[model samples]
Each structure stands twice: as C-alpha cells, then as structure tokens.
Target: MTQELGPLAREVAMSYYEDALPAHDRFHAKRVRDVSIRLANECDEPVDRDVLSAAAWLHDIGRPLERTNEIDDHDEWGAREAAALLEAEGVTSDRIEAVACCIRTHSIRSSSPEPETLEAKLLFDADKLDAVGARGLVRLACIVGERSGRTGERHAVIDDTSVFGTIASDQPDISLLRKWARERLDRLYTSPGRRLGESRWEFMEDFFAQFDAEIGVDGKR
Candidate 1:
C-alpha cells in the first residue's frame, strides 16, 4: 500500500514545500517519515505503514498557506487537503481518513485534534522529535535567524566548531530554543519516543552547558 502511495504523496508534498522555509521544507518531511518508520518498527502493536507514510509526507503541505496567513491552522488544512488529494488518487475512504487523522493531530496546538490511534501517536511523536535534538537546534536557529534578520551570522555561528566562543552569551533565541525543547521533551507519547527524546534532550543540555561556559554565561568560567 505504502509502496505506491508513498511516492505519490511525497511528490505532492514536495510541490507544496517548493518555496517553504528551511525549517519546514520537504527534507523535514522526509526526516519525519524516516523517524516515523523507525519508531513504528520498535512498537509492539501493529502500525499501518501506508497511513503513516502518507500522513508523514503530507503533514506539512499546508505550512506555506499558514505562513502566508491564507490559513489559520496547517494541521487542519493539510488534513482536509490530504483527504481530497488521496480521494482523487482512488484511495479508500478509511485509509484517507486514517491519514488525515494523523495529520490533523500531529502538532501540539490546543486547537489541533488529539491523536487517537497508534499511527497518529507515532506520527505526532516523529514530528515533535525533529524539534528537540541537534537537528531541532539547527531548525530553530534558521527560524530565529530569519526572524532576527541575522541569517548569515546565525549560520556562521552554527558552522563554527567553536560556536560557543563566537556566539553571544545573552542571545534571546537560545533561551527560546531551550524553552521550546523542554516543552517538546515533555510532550512525547510512546516509550520509544520518550527514550529517543531523552537522549536527544541530554545532548541539547550538554551543548547548552558548554555554550554557556565558553561564553561566561550562567556564572560559568
């Protein structure tokens, strides 16, 4: 099932992400797909790979619309759009609904639907996993850089092996990223997800600790 729909869904998702931000680009979707499959393999319960794959690929398709204020919620919008697109592709109603349900609740917004099924929970965990690790820092850096009008500076800081030495100690973006990462760490659902997230969270903490020490922040010498 996924063998056919996966490629088709990816192609459709790519079109939507053609001009997307670096943080939420098509590659981000691909990473989420990989994580979803990996987590699914570790689960004791059965998972519908077809629904998971389709949902992972199409999850962020409405991001561009949301970014432009054309839509208020990408998850909800993407779910509806995915259902229509899958229906057009001759997918069964149940499969389309399954995929849509996963997309509709992938994010942790208050208004977003709660993930009810194992597939949806996996998708949710996979998506959030990208927001807390080394990759998560890079994504947040890209976003913060873009917002602060310092993309080149932020890239330079990230590219440096001695980034701590070069980075500003009091940058608000770093604080924001830390806060967001902590929140994401607490939001993980599955046991496998929690295990993976805990490891990543530790890495992030170590990185930040070193960063603080190098820059003489947090009273570190």
Candidate 2:
C-alpha cells in the first residue's frame, strides 16, 4: 500500500514545502512518517498503515499556506488537502476519511476532536516526538534563526513564543529549551510514545544541566 501511495504523497508534500525552511521541509515530514510507522508496528492496537502513511505525509501540507495567512489553521487545511490527495489516488472513501481525521488532529496545539484512533495517536506522538531532545533543539534553532534574520543566535524569537511562555526576555535559552522539552514530555499519548519521550526528555534535561553548569548558571561552581 505504501509502495503505491508513498511516492504520490511525497511528491505533493514536497511541492508544498518547496519554499519552506529546512526545519519544516520534506526531511521533517519523512521523519514523522517513519516514526509513526515505527510506533504503529510496536503497538498492540490495530492501525491502518495506508491511512497512517497518507496522514503522516499530508499532516503539514497546510503549514505553508497558514504561514502566508491563506489559511487560518494548518491542521484543518491539511485535512482537506489530504482527503483530496487520497481521493485522487483512488483510496477508499472510508480510509480517506480516516486519513483526513488523523491529519486534522495531529497537532500538539489542537484541542477539539483529539486523536482517538490508534493511527491518529501514533501520528500525533510521532510528530511531537520530533520536537524534542537534540534534534528538536536544532529545529527550533533553525526557526529562530529564520525569524530573527540571524543565523544560529540560540535566542528565542519574540514573535514566536511557543516554548518560552511569558518569561522575561533575559531568561537563558537553555531554560526556554528545557521548558519546551518538559511540555512535550507531558503530552505523550501511546505507551511506546511515553517510553520514547522519557528517554528524549532525560536527554534534554541532561544536556541542559551540562549547559547550565558550563555557563555557571543556577549558581553552578
């Protein structure tokens, strides 16, 4: 199934992300898709892999449009886009609906219609998992650099305040990064997700501890 749909999905996804920053491009989608498939394989629950594959590939389809104000919400927009793509591929309507639902609610910030299906949960978990630990830090740094018009300053952008909360501007980057990792850890859903998240969270915590120690923050000698 993936052998048939994977190429089509990737082609569509790549077109949308053509002008996207490296952090939010095809590589990111591929990682999320791979992680989602892995989690589905590990889980005892029954999941439709074809639906999962299509959902994972189209999850971020709305990001570019949302960034330009052409759409209000990326998840909702992406869901519509995924449905169209799946229909074009001759996927069954029921399966297409399942895929669309997964794309619709895969976001960490999404509130309504939370992921109930195993496939959706895996997609959500996989997507959030990518936003933690070392890779997550690298991704955030790239976004920050893009927003700040500077390359790798390690400072959170004022306009993009998702991780930093309402803290003072003087707070260290390590503190902000730690806060984000903790938040991500708290949001894991599946058993495999929790296990993967624990290790990643610990890695982030350890990295921050070492960083603070080197910088002499928190009264470190």
> Could you list the CA RMSD of all candidates, in the order they appear?
5.3, 5.2
Candidate 1 displacement at residue 43 in angstroms: 0.2
Alpha-carbon local distance difference test for all models: 0.83, 0.76
Q: Give one digit per residue, the lDDT tens place, for model 1 in 1-221.
A: 34487777887778899878888889999999999999999999998987899899999999888877799999989999999988887888998899999999999877877899999999999998898889988887776666665343432233224344644443443567888778877888898889899999999999888866775543323
Task: Output the lDDT of residue 47, model 2.
Answer: 79
Tell me the spans in candidate 1 whose CA falls farther than 4 Å from its real position: 1-3, 146-173, 216-221
Model 1, total clashes: 0
TM-score against truth, every candidate: 0.85, 0.83
Q: After superposing candidate 2, which stretches have Cα over 4 Å from the reference?
A: 1-3, 110-112, 146-172, 216-221
Q: Give me candidate 2's TM-score against the actual structure.
A: 0.83
lDDT score, candidate 2, position 37: 88
- In model 1, pairs of residues that clash are none
Q: Which is the leading candidate under lDDT? A: 1
